[model samples]
Target: MLGHPWAATELGPLPTWDPAVRAATDLVLASPVPMALTLGDELLLLYNDAYAELIGDKHPAALGRPAAEVFGEVWSMPGVGDVIEHAYRTGEPFLEKEATLPIHRRADVAEQSVFTRGSCAVRDSAGRVVGVLTVAAEITQVTRQLQSLGDFAAALAGTLTLDDVARVALRYALTVFDADRVSFAVDEGGGGWRMVRRVRGELMDEADERLPPLWRRGPADWPAPAVEAARRGGASYVDDGEPLRGIAVDRHDQKVRALAAVPLRAAAVRGGITVGHHDPHSWSAADRALLAASAELIGQAAERARRFETQHGTAQLLQRSMLPEHLPDLPRLRIAARYDPGVDGNAAGGDFYDAFQLPTGELGIVLGDVAGHDVQAAARMGQVRAALRALALNDPRPDQVLAGLDRLVTSLGAEGATHELFVTVVFGVIDADRSQVTLASAGHPAPLVRRCAPDGQARATYVDVPAGAPLGLGSRPVTRTVPFHPGDTLLLFSDGVVERRQQGLDRGLATLAEAVAGAHSGDPRALCAAATAAVPGATEDDVAVLAVEHALRPSRSASMEVPAEPTAPSRVRHWLTGQLTEWQVPETVVGAAVLCTSELTTNALLHAGTAARVEIDLSPERLLVSVADSGTRGTVTRARTDTLSSRGRGLGLIEDLTDAWGTDPTVRGSTVWFEILLPAG
Candidate 1:
């Protein structure tokens, strides 16, 4: 209901009703006491019998016409529309402090006179606001008393902050006439006026800060001449804050005057004030330069701060997307990364760590910190990570591997004209064969390895990866190795973890070592989390961590049988037929394999670059037919991609005919592979 366009205000959970709703509406329209109205996007004037005698107009006939149509510019009052919306927004009855409406009294006289007005919002089911109701009286005497207050109570009701009120006033002020800039400055105490808020002259996403400085705090930071002049001035100053207060106004085209500064106060003391004036002209009290309204200007500043906080919350959410929940399996190692951005409402820094299975089934682990923060840093982090993965797959030798990355970064920076990122990266490839972890750094932190004790306490051991330069700016490739036997855990982190603003790098490393040594659990991921939690949310920068714990080599099952006859395509085909007959397999498998085997075998002989043999491992889970040749070329093109017209069906048939298929290009050659789903017998 709150989301409904017709309903105003934030949605409330329950029904809210005035105990005498209908009766109140009736009494509101009745007599000398009845100063009432109804709104339909515009106001309609009404007068009671006794009041009608004073105005000399028929009541019912005057109902439909607007006060403006009847009275012209004489009835124009700024902020009247907002006064109505405020009533709807707050769901409250309002008596405008001091406001005037010009309306006709006698049909013979044919002229509009002044009167005062009031209103309240109407609401509907679901406790949602629907419209506004009003009771406006013609109080000429009341208007004089209100001369001090200006029907502002109703106009400013829904506003919780001074900035909000100023914005409301400025909007009305701007609508009535075009202005170059509208600003609200607040008085702190003795002699300072802080420029708390301003609506951009015109909203431009790419607003440049290269122009003359816009002051945010007080006169101390203001332009030199203005600072001196404002020091001696009262609570407010118009365009004369600098010039007219101490010099002639002829220096500029904008002659400053009528630049009324209203002294704002809760009781007696001057708070601050809002000052306004036309650029090519002088200002006046009615010129919307009412400085006495500084209280509302202060309110506007608080609103801006609240808005900043909301946007800050949103940016934090966007940053969360960089962290992954699970790391892909790398045969002998378990890995995870924890990115603690540290504090809320803070900028997102460039701290990234990623570990995923490489094409070789090896775990490619990377930790790097690009300089700076926000979306740009995280996005750059992504670019470096993706490039690292691609480079590792092409050719991986720690120093050589990272050197390749340096070339990539250099090219990317040159192409994009990227800023020189003073980054450091540590790259490690955990061998799938449990041989060891090859460690390399482009000047990143040395990875920490800890042996998890039976009691959950881990003894920290830092791996010996050679020192090298960071990437981008410049770096010599460096490499080292760590034998990652089944149980050791490796920890990778960014500077945010242990590096304090004043602390030395060595002390930071030692602190990390202590934290890891104290943590229980063989899970490298858990230890990474424990160390991060120990610091709380006080980090000023970003912390990216990668924890890798190798998996114990699991025993796998294998079966083999020798058949008489040669392992030629014909013999293999016959063997499959014979095996299917024995197993009572269906005819479909019998048929699909006839062409699948013939083309596979023929291709092996014709294009398979080496003498690598053909092996078929059939099981209930799958039927794996692999002709692993020394063939480093060609891919398992899908049937859709195959115009291998006459004989090209080898791959086409595999895709159209098999469930899943792929090729694992290795150091030896590419193994174009495929899988066939086997029917349960």
Candidate 2:
């Protein structure tokens, strides 16, 4: 009243002010809540200290100014200026909750504020209203905190892996708590902890998905507070770094003045999360509640992920152990196989495949599937595969092999008394002369053949072998013969490859035929890879594929396993030269073949990271050579000018000296082959 010139002009001298105005001024000054009094026609503003804080920097200067001038920026905001005007004009009191006010706290941006406020008419002793009195309680911070917790719950619900849970929890904690750093740690059960820490500067924009914040790991200097919370199975807090005194901390952690830790509420796992601030902060009840809720959500996600990882690991180990480690290597016949488990990783699949040489020098191929996806089913599949191999070794006939298998399956079913003991299989035998393939099916899907014409065109056809009842049902299998000429590929697969949840088996079979016809028909490895990927989406059942190509064994052919060593390539060169010379091959052809074979061996050892198999077939017209490796380094391609570079010179030599060259990618590794045509006699 003494400092403002407006006080003198608007309400006369301070000592001579109206009794009612004086009483109102005294009331405003005494209240703790935000309050303001607008008196007379101009609605001249008078406010207490609590109300001044709401106006920010406009406090001292707004003593006796008009309401519109004092709050010019936010006076027009809804539920503010309009509500006050209505109370003053109609003499009616107004109360509103969650009223929004766009108050300008910064020069360029307006801060949104939510408040529960009420305004009532201020009347003189004459019983006539002259102004409005407003009282407000800001709930902005509380409302925002609740909204953030909701978002955190929604985000945690979709996380399915341990890494996902850690990443999301750390990011949200750093932002929601306004902390300098956030850490998440899980007890690894052996005195070791896997911890991830994210600092404030690591936060990324919401729209950028390419580069996520850096997640640092390890047990280096674990956060002492978080570990303590996990051990106690409760929350811990300190406002002045009291708990961190005398504890081992890095230079960055030395700046933390406040810390809060919440233990994860998982029943099967032990872990906790911690948040730290650079400046001293008193955690309110709302803050503690939010932290506890967040920790609960994280705990649930982590438990689910832990269970899934355990089951998936067990299933994978069982599936791989039941299958063959390596297929039989033949001189004139090329073989490749593929196996993939179903989407449900918790159960071991019953699909199986095998190939071995018979006592009569013919090759035996078999594929089968049991009826279930469990440990029992996988065990029965192994029994069936082993029995078939033994039966085929005794007699190389396809029908006889299946007949023995049928009896064994029937006996196993009777002994075990389980429907899952029944099985479906296709057994085939390739004659030593490579003239034809004899196959027998026991209630199994028909095998496909990719026949290549002399004109270089190819087509796929399903063999019309008569089907018998599935094994264990006591039906006889009939053997059928198909002409297996050079460049023809035989594809045997389990029904899982052609069974889809959304389509019929016929459509899936047709789709597989089209995919096989379009594949490289001469390369069995490539065909196997293509056939496995023929179905687009997630498969409900496990898939197993086997492809064999007939190369027509020449009068002279040889094969050897090249070791993965520096001297392996040199040995290959020497061995190839000697073999060609012993076969009386032309000198020029021997020189070219040796050079090409050496380059391939060297490339395989360098990139494949495993032992490689090398095979060569020579006839009067051409020499066919291939290098196969079990490592996953697949096909290599180069640009037009890359042939002469040091990194690509191996391919350069092959391209220059060979009549034709290509690469075939298989399930486990790849095959690179080149052909050299000799002069006709």
lDDT at 326, model 1: 42
User: What TM-score would each prediction reach against the true structure?
Assistant: 0.38, 0.64
lDDT of 2: 0.78
List runs of model 2 lying over 4 Å from the truth: 1-164, 167-182, 197-228, 236-260, 275-284, 329-336, 411-422, 430-436, 450-459, 466-468, 483-489, 517-529, 548-681
Predicted model with the maximum lDDT: 2
The TM-score that candidate 1 achieves is: 0.38
In model 1, what lDDT does residue 213 have?
17
Which runs in model 1 stand beyond 4 Å of their true positions? Answer: 1-319, 322-325, 329-332, 342-346, 416-419, 452-457, 534-537, 552-681
The lowest-lDDT stretch of 10 consecutive residues in candidate 1 is 204-213
Q: Rate the local accuracy (lDDT) of all candidates.
A: 0.54, 0.78
